[model samples]
Target: MEHEATRITGTDLDPEAAFQRRLGAVVQAVEERIAALLDDAPRRGEIARPARLVAAMRHAMLGGGKRLRPFLVIETAALFGVPFAHALNGACALELVHGYSLVHDDLPAMDDDDLRRGRPTVHKAFDEATAILAGDALLTLAFDVAADESSHTDPAVRAAFVQGLARAAGLGGMVGGQMIDLAAEGRYGDVLLDEARVRRLQAMKTGALIAFAVDAGALLGRAPLGDRQALGAYGRAVGAAFQIADDILDRESSAAAMGKRTDKDAGKGKATLVGVLGLERARRERDTLVEAAIAALASFGAKADILRSAARFTASRQS
Candidate 1:
């Protein structure tokens, strides 16, 4: 069935409102997809789904957040006229991986946060062991969703998604970035992280999956090489801006406003562009990235206006 975003009117009349409507529709779609994916029934070749594990996964994955990554997947795919159903599958898969990351990130071994999205984190709501297993299950399920026939009719597209998602979530991508972040926090040793290294770390930890959101859309649409490269550049810039904006929020926004603990990055001495360049400079850098991101979409003209708005929103978000 067609999602609500495609049926919206008056893009020329009120672009911002139109964008918000589209984003809301995609968020709702993602929420519904996650619930179905986390159902108690076991799929083919799988053993029984443990009650507690599935509950923990559902608790972490559902009922919160903007679902920005999924929005990117669906919106970018729409650029090439891929149907909402095909793109929504990829969106849900990406969100599953993102949800798993947050579960792991909030563990005692990592950020150790008690709250997430204004509620108790998975580890706090459930036991640490259950949280770990839930995260593992979510990550494994992501590949299953990506490879499922619903994600794409072409086996080649499915294979590309599987390979791309693995690399993005694997040792060289988000996971590797987390390790570098830990090392910077004196987990392994007191290795001082410079600005360049911090940028690289954030790119992997936060940016890889985001970039993959856009790239997945391109792959689903079978975009030309030049268009794919352009989207990649736009994705990278937007990802960087997003992390910077997040760091700025950590410094300036309150826990109540952010729906989680604030000022923790400074307390932990975590390296961030905001810390390295200061708030004003970080804001400037973020704005610059947003501008670059918008510029990268010049070839697509008004067709990418919503994407341009997305880049701007990344830099300007309060949380």
Candidate 2:
């Protein structure tokens, strides 16, 4: 007899399997390009002092991630008719910044997660000091990669792109989100977090990088202001929906299903949509946000199919 399905047992139809079948090609192409860029990243020279730090940096950066941010960059660029090669460095840079955040977020002082992407956390696999340095290195190197003029034919446009990325990855965006997350833990104990406040947190934390991804792609493709605005709206909606879905999965999904620890949010007293809204309401909100995300892509016509699929996947993903 065939082995019973593990995580997905009830239904004969597998949504994730179908999604992977449709998205696997795009994901593979994006992964290969990202891997090449990562492999080419310089870790260290013959210099002795920083060699260990370089090695740590390489280890953390090379370790696994979904590369979702980079994929967003590539997909958005494709929607606008930009060549994937032209946006590869920007996409890679986004992934580097994202990886850096994960490394730092996994530290004992932060989320204190021992596992990530089904592997030992950076701080666990490597030492704590090494993980810290690795995160810093990736964060700094992301800007360096983005600023490389050789990647783009137009130096002026490349400079603008670099500036945009810096702003997004720095205090105004991802870093700011992290700061808020750190501050909010256990502050308002047992009080129901209002929807607006949760949305604010989600926008800064999760939505910022996503918005950056779309904006960077639009810039690379020389898209008009209208197109950029539309894409930005799409990113924000889907990004928030993604986080909400994550909240749902954290409560309902098993550890094996998530490939990481579950219920950590509730354990930490963190504010989430599920924490604020009831579970049923949270699921409804996610669906609503997903619909809004898809609607935002309506201006793109058929070219936005990949983005539409991504939005649906974001709301429906078990992982």
Candidate 3:
């Protein structure tokens, strides 16, 4: 199975099956890493770990979605011949930040979501304060893991990971984009969401971290400047397509199908390409981005077919 799974040739087996096999491996590894990170035992320089806090953090991190961000890190690192073991912790760190974002995103003051991954959200399953703390802890733990020597041998690479992730999650990136999204909802005042503004919001909110995920792999392997730029392009294209696909899913998918509320984007007046470009055009744009993402990998040749498939899956994913 290991031999079969590592091979990415199109004719060797079913493409979707192979892609899913690789993805499942990443999800399993990330889940195990997260569980270990949230364990009851305190690490060096930490006080006693609180049981409830650990449980809340565990609930927010474990048994969740596709873990696509981690997959991108691991897979892209492999493109540069970096072993998965070397990349695993960094991948886990990125996913930890993603989990933290979702926990906070589902808060009463934010999207106010009740269900996530078909289960009660952190705030719903636990308490709001606990949920908030869990998010904070998860975000902090991400930096911990990224800073650890296990993530990379070079201090420079680890430092880059820390700085890059902070930038991706900080004011100029996901958090700022979230603020813009909320303001666009008329939470503060009237904010016109033209196509340009909508695209910018999505790029910052969703694209930044995703682009970081791919770039982290390049950093991990210390890839050349040109290769790094190529992966960056791929990540940006996929990231944009991802948000467009999400908006389309919100409009067209059922709550039961999505494991969360649907039809809420329009109701909240959230800035989305689907809202600005209409469903048909949004879909066309997504397809175009998928192609562009693939084209960005042209320099990597057959080694990047898995990534090419990933771009397709991102655009066409039902959930």
Candidate 4:
């Protein structure tokens, strides 16, 4: 996945443009890998076959968005000189898990959204039952993708990938955070959660999977223990900053700009940094977190230039 910058390749381009070219390469690689994975899945005829479910899963997982999590996995893996093909399996697995989350999160019982990435959500495009099943299938398939022998020749590395993804995507991480989120908004019952509780919720719900993406890549590459720890810190800081930036965008931007509904958190009584710290302070905090995240990668030098750019983008993004 290394792109040598030459005059023919636009080495004369601005740093942002050059960086974007690299990012685009990662995006295209992962998208193609994911598509192939779906197309080649084990298919059986009727008698409870998964044709419709596969269709739903494919609809939700492919041809969309920034694919930032996959980029993190690929770039972190590259730090150890891992081949692009070696990283593709894990990158696609993480994207599947992310796609699953979004599918479930958009359910009528969850975020109750009608659109995602400017199209009808899985639940709306198909039916509520199909959406739920598609999400479940995606989550389960992620582990299978990680366990594939081609992902890593070493069984131990493959095992680590599976274990890491489960922990990050499970109760201690994203799903657990979603539970807290639902409760905080009184989906279960009334409860006045404080700033600390809300912050914890955001960290687990959003930050956990992101941290896993970076740290798991380091593990798959067998990077030094110290390097793995640093990447973990970077992931957590960037994850929090990402949520804060999302809050700002939801408050300040339009639905069309975001390609989804905006300004809905307040209506749902969701606790966000902007609500707790106010918009100005939240923006400052996000900026500070971005700096902290970039500092965590200082030891990597220019090898981690893409990661540094990612943190900066997370802090300043409008949608």
**Using TM-score as the measure, which candidate wins?**
1
**Clash statistics: count for each candidate:** 0, 0, 0, 0
Q: In model 4, what is the error at residue 151, expressed in angstroms?
A: 1.0
Q: What TM-score fits each model? A: 0.98, 0.86, 0.96, 0.93
- Tell me the spans in candidate 3 whose CA falls farther than 4 Å from its real position: 1-11
Pairs in steric clash, model 4: none
Worst 10 residues of 1 by lDDT: 8-17
Please, what are the lDDT tens digits per residue for candidate 1 over residues 105-140? Answer: 999999999999999999999999999999998999
RMSD, every candidate, angstroms? 1.1, 6.7, 1.8, 2.8
Query: How much does candidate 4 score in TM-score?
Result: 0.93
Error of 4 at 78 (Å): 1.0
lDDT of 3 by residue, 27-107 (tens): 787887788888999999998999999999999889888788999998999888888778999999999999999999999
Residue 68, candidate 4: Cα error in Å is: 0.6
Off by over 4 Å in 2: 1-55, 187-193
Model 1, total clashes: 0
The segments of candidate 1 whose C-alpha lies over 4 angstroms from its true place after superposition are: 9-12
Tens-digit per-residue lDDT, 1-319, candidate 2: 2211112221343544533543554455545654555453454542343656665656665645566677678778866677666677888888788888888988998899988878788788879989998888778778777877745778876888888877776787778877667667855344455778778877877788888888888888888899899998998888888899999999999888887899888888787889888799999999999999899988787657767778888887778
Q: Model 4, range 1-319, lDDT digits (tens) per residue? A: 4433111132465545655776788787877778777774564432443778878988898867778788788778878878767888898899899999999999989899998888899999999999999999899889888998988999999998899899989999899999998998987889787889888999988888888889878977999999998998899998899899989999999988887899998899898988888999999999999999999999998777778888888976667
Query: How many clashing pairs in candidate 4?
Result: 0
Q: All models: lDDT?
A: 0.91, 0.75, 0.90, 0.85
* lDDT of prediction 3: 0.90
- Which candidate leads the pack in lDDT? 1
